[model samples]
Target: MDRTPANDTWFQGKAARSIHEDQLKKVELFNGRAAMIGFVIGVITEGLTGQGILHQIGLGPLVDGYATCSVQMLPFCF
Candidate 1:
């Protein structure tokens, strides 16, 4: 532990670490807000179109086919 300026700069105090942690917190908050907004938009679109999220994304047939095969006990659905 020579306590040189370079070593001091590399080892930050609690305040400096807190600043970086605050930035990460803000980023996580914004990401969570965006996810909530997207989910609400998806629900509204589904309500207006009378279609599920999967159907709106054009995966309804693929999902339905898989369900049918699974129910019929098909050997290889993949």
Candidate 2:
């Protein structure tokens, strides 16, 4: 006896080419990786600038302030 699909609505003989296939995840995975790298760079630049401004204005803990700013971007990275 042979087992096969009863309908073609979903399968369409292309099940092997579906996005659900692990290999199809490469595009999305690459995009996510690129976005993560860009986000980290943006966070670092922005935080450093803020810290520089604060220090020039005689504020204390400028480095801590910058570090705190960078922390806020962590959740948004992913």
lDDT of 2 by residue, 1-78 (tens): 434565553465567567467675887899899999977776776587754444544764755655576565855543
By TM-score, the best candidate is 1
**Top candidate (lDDT):** 1
Each candidate structure's TM-score, on Cα atoms with residue i matched to residue i, is: 0.68, 0.38
lDDT of 1 by residue, 2-69 (tens): 98987787677766998999999999999999999988988999999988889888999987888778
How good is model 1 by TM-score?
0.68
Error of 2 at 13 (Å): 3.5
Q: Which ten contiguous residues of candidate 1 have the minimum total lDDT?
A: 69-78
lDDT for model 1: 0.86
Question: Relative to the unseen true structure, what is the Cα RMSD of model 1?
Answer: 3.6
Q: State each candidate's clash count.
A: 0, 0
- Backbone clash tally (model 1): 0
